[model samples]
Target: MTITELAKQWQTVIHHKPPIEKDPTSNDLLILIPGNPGLVNFYICYLDLIQQQFPNFEILCISHAGCDPNSYELFKFYGLKDQIVSKYEIIKKFVMDNEYSTKYNLYFLSHSVGCYINQRMVKLLLDDMSLVSHVDIKYVGLICPTIKDISKSVSGVRITKLFNYTPIITVLSILSSVLTRLLSDNYLLGIIEHYHIIKKPALVDFVSQLNYTNSTLGALNIVSKSHIVKQVLTLACEEMKLINEEKDINDWFFHDLGSKVKVWVYFADSDHWVNDKTRDELIKDYYDEDNHNNIRFELGKSDDGITHSFCIDKSVEFARITTNAIRRLN
Candidate 1:
């Protein structure tokens, strides 16, 4: 798969699966967006699983602008808002240029911070009556979404504590970048195998393709930049507050896409980044009479031991749950 530049300064890895029939009834497209450290390769296993289940659907995963492993830079002028806008532009261009809105059904699968971008993109589409009227967005699946203030959450507090040591994070980022340049994919694979971190051969291959330097730099940017961290935390907190107050969160944030699109939200039972308290609160909000029909929420089994980064350790289970969720939409 080659990386294509979708927009000015934005590049994405595309995986196209042509429809079996020349004129199939449904030519659906599944777009996956990763969270902080937005490395598209990290979701390869999950992508592969979904493709296997729905062979007719084409999948596209976009990395953050300038976040590709080959072009790792320490100081890039990219932030949360910029990332979201870039994604919106990329998707809008693709759908309009290919007439995908008329030819295909659209589904968004977002993880962590990508859920924010997905919501913003949906809002953009909703605001453009001309564009939205033609587009048929069937479903949106948010996996381990960090949509509310995480600072007060279990994982947020821990991450905040870790970020308090700016020097350590910077040093680690620099070291990781340097090591990534020196180490071969095989060497990394060997280390992972030695530790038995992942047993599946296909998943191991997918992970081997990641760009560590880019991921490290992406992580560093999110941790070191006060403004970026503040923005994410604030958005999450405000969203929860509105939901708790029984305000029209859909109208306020999603531009009413919450009503138009079927939403499946998957949350890990013990996610540190999104604590149980906040997760339950959001579930209650989604279950409100107004949203009960549009939103479907699920919590991962506590015995499964899934973490915030389930893509790494629980890819198969994650894929299974996502597949089941999408099936429900059908």
Candidate 2:
């Protein structure tokens, strides 16, 4: 089959059958949760790398409501999505029902905001340990996780925070979201600034090619043309308001860390988008890597030609590092 056809077939299988069930009887299953607005295509390259290295593993990729192109039909606006938290709750329920593993080791591959959801899920699991026994979730692979030390990381109104102001930021956020839906999944502006893919062979072209081949853009358009974007955008606006109003309150620091899971953070040495202070706090406060060796930090050297978006870069060396990490965890 052509690459495009194969991509579509894979999407079909994933949608129909949970990606997490790749190896139900296996010792461990890799669950990849995407960050921000993204499709499975975003991580296909990485998945390909993992498959080559460890051919005997099961891989499940979960695209959250706000992140999935298919969900855009249920949420069109994009900038004001409040149901994100609710969507995550649903995912939690799914995990509980399918593999409430006390013994089955679960490894996570998360990127950016995906880490936030993963942490939240871990907290929920910790709350009622009986709902799950053992909860053998270990080795979280976070690619530039967006767990911000709110006080230090978040500055004034970021371009994304436009959703906080209805007439100004909200309008722009909606416009950009829709424009991205219409123009291209890997559109240059969307790829670089918002998505932050700073790797070579022009990561934009690489992602764009995948989107085109995989029909990701088309599926996304289907959802965008529906009412999903509107609902999701409205939800985002509400969340933005919560964020804004809560700024005066200094309690947004991540208190979700527990001894249930181990973490492996992969971050660039210098990423302007994700502040260093925030990273330090995540290491110190959230994971307590300073005190605990369970959570390991691998600072990618930008000087050696790595950037913030190394997760999806086309560089062979970059691919090797990424695949090796997943293999080592396995």
Best by lDDT: 1
Task: Give the TM-score (vs. native) of candidate 2.
Answer: 0.63
Q: For candidate 2, lDDT tens digit of each residue in 1-330?
A: 432243232221132122432444555556676654445555666665565565544566655444433332333343312223433344344445554333546677777656655655544555655646544666677777665542233432363455444455345446656665677544533445444333234444654455333433423442333333443345333433433212221123222243334556787677644677667755654555342555556778756666654444433455577676765544
| Residue-wise C-alpha lDDT for candidate 1, range 203-266, written one tens digit per residue | 4355433433233333444433333343344434333333222235434543356666788888
Candidate 1 lowest-lDDT run of ten: 237-246
Candidate 2: count of backbone clashes, pairs at least 3 residues apart or interchain: 24
Q: Which number leads on TM-score? A: 1
Task: Give the C-alpha lDDT of model 1.
Answer: 0.63
lDDT scores in order: 0.63, 0.50
